[model samples]
Target: MVTTSIPTTTKSWTVLGTDGFDSLKFSKDTPLPAVSDYEVLVKFHAASLNYRDLIIPKGQYPFAQKPGIVPGSDGAGEVVAVGNKVTLFKPGAKVVTLFNQGHLGGSLNPQTSATGLGGVIDGTLRQYGTFNENGLVDMPASLNWQEASTLSCAALTAWNALYGLNKLQPGQTVLTQGTGGVSIFAAQFAIAAGATVISTTSSAEKGELLKKLGVDHVINYNETPDWGAKAKELTPKGEGVDHIVEVGGPTTMEQSLNAIKIDGTITIIGFLGGVQGEKQPGFLDALVRMCTVRGVLVGNRVQFEEMNRAIEANKIKPVVDPKVFSLEDAKSAYQYMWDRKHFGKLTIKIE
Candidate 1:
């Protein structure tokens, strides 16, 4: 591994308060932290956004956060410098940060729970940040920086939902809600795995994009209010879907319960529809249906590695929003995502 002179400061987007998007400010010269023996200094090229990024600024995330913290969990960059003890990555190697640095391959616990980035601590929405070696994973060579940046959080979460515990078999059916990063990746991964994908979106435009990504059916939730029943009707032989990537929380869970087959799985990942809805499903519905609900928190490092390998083999490319934002325009970028206009991952380019 080659070595280079470390810099003293780097540019970053810092959240000054939980006052929404306006609170995010561009820091022209945030001081860089020194790399310790087990750490590597990454020069981030690009970072991607998630739904949590939207709520964190409003202090809504369950994890504790600090003011003036750099807020992001997904990025890919070159390793400009590495500590003597860092053998996994070195100078010039391309890598992305794991959302949880402590939970590499085991079950979740307090220690891993405390290590979540962007919320538990400062995250990767900056040009340079030092990460523990264990938290860094190699980016697939087949993907560019923007595409690889999408993997750390949303992509890995989708992978965990589909294949982490309950593997989807060939000819099975999956129902994904919305065209966000996680749902889109779930559709792509399910299609690659030989499963039929049924996706829901807010607009026909976004629904068309999902169809292009190999979704067999795209249900416009606005047009089809009772999308769950529609999804059930669309499945093989009128049977319900085998799995659902449930990201809408309370607002969409009732329908998810209606759309899933007996003994099916629903991986509850996010609360995009917020905490409550007009009509919430009862526990009896899940009990009677014999459906399993597994809550996903991104994923572990081992699953991330497996997802990367699959990406490489399948030539999977993340659908990044074309409008690129610089670190200085991070606030507008957040607002763009908040507006719900983007069809795929929103990204920021770091120079």
Candidate 2:
């Protein structure tokens, strides 16, 4: 009789049910997945959070959640083993996981939506994981594990918003609402593209931080309720911003429409201001201004690679929050992100 060896196991965090943050629980004996012919085994080093990660467990995301699914979308790690057919990555390679495993290029479709990590399948929160070689990209040489982890979702979404569709041009003006991870990345990417950046934040201190980051103008939304009009006035000749990274949904859409130039673009990436409440700008609003409004998901692997190239070329750094957490304290990390107190990306280290 032949005997087969059992695969090793490791610790991981998962969403037990549709119960929100409290559903995030840890398991010390989760099975370590094995590499298939086109797969690679990775030893996770760090993982980061996105707003999507916060609502996924609560059944608030657009997609249906799988039972007992691991709950993380952004992660960086080192390859520990590779399947015989895996040529793109070998053991010891530093890589970042792709947000969507099936969407390598082209456009988003049902297949692409199904590939979303932490949404329809197991994700990156585990200490060890096996992924298809095509589902991962090399981490930027200039970034550390944590910094690289930040790119998988938030940074990539911001990159997709600016470069995915119409390609933001230099000398144009971009308005970013709030100082969240995506907003900061949009500002940084817009600046790198030689565009003028006008940022809005709730407090005076965050506005100062945006200034230090080289934003051309900072509007305190708390002080200026009509910040959208103010943003338009701040643009050259009051022509309005050429692009608006619209993270706030119904609450800020009308203002975004007001701030944008005729024929401008608005990338809807998040709903930090809550998904419900006031009615949002409909198609008529966009048509009236001849504007293009796009829903920005995290980019494909091709876009991810391009974003990394730009990161290395421009020496762009991710704005991560000062406080760090271990894998055991992941719940508290999510809570912090929920509180909206962190200015930038919040991360967890896997030990």
lDDT of 1 at 211: 81
Q: How many backbone clashes does candidate 2 have?
A: 0
Give per-model TM-scores: 0.97, 0.97
Q: Relative to the true structure, how large is the alpha-carbon lDDT of every model?
A: 0.89, 0.88
* Model 1: lowest-lDDT 10 consecutive positions: 60-69
Give the per-residue lDDT of model 1 (tens digit) for 56-99: 88888877566777899999999999888888986999999899
lDDT of 2 by residue, 128-207 (tens): 88788898999999999989989999898899999888889999999999999999999999999999999999888998
Could you tell me the lDDT of residue 241 within candidate 1? 92
Off by over 4 Å in 2: 1-7
Q: Candidate 2: lDDT over CA atoms?
A: 0.88
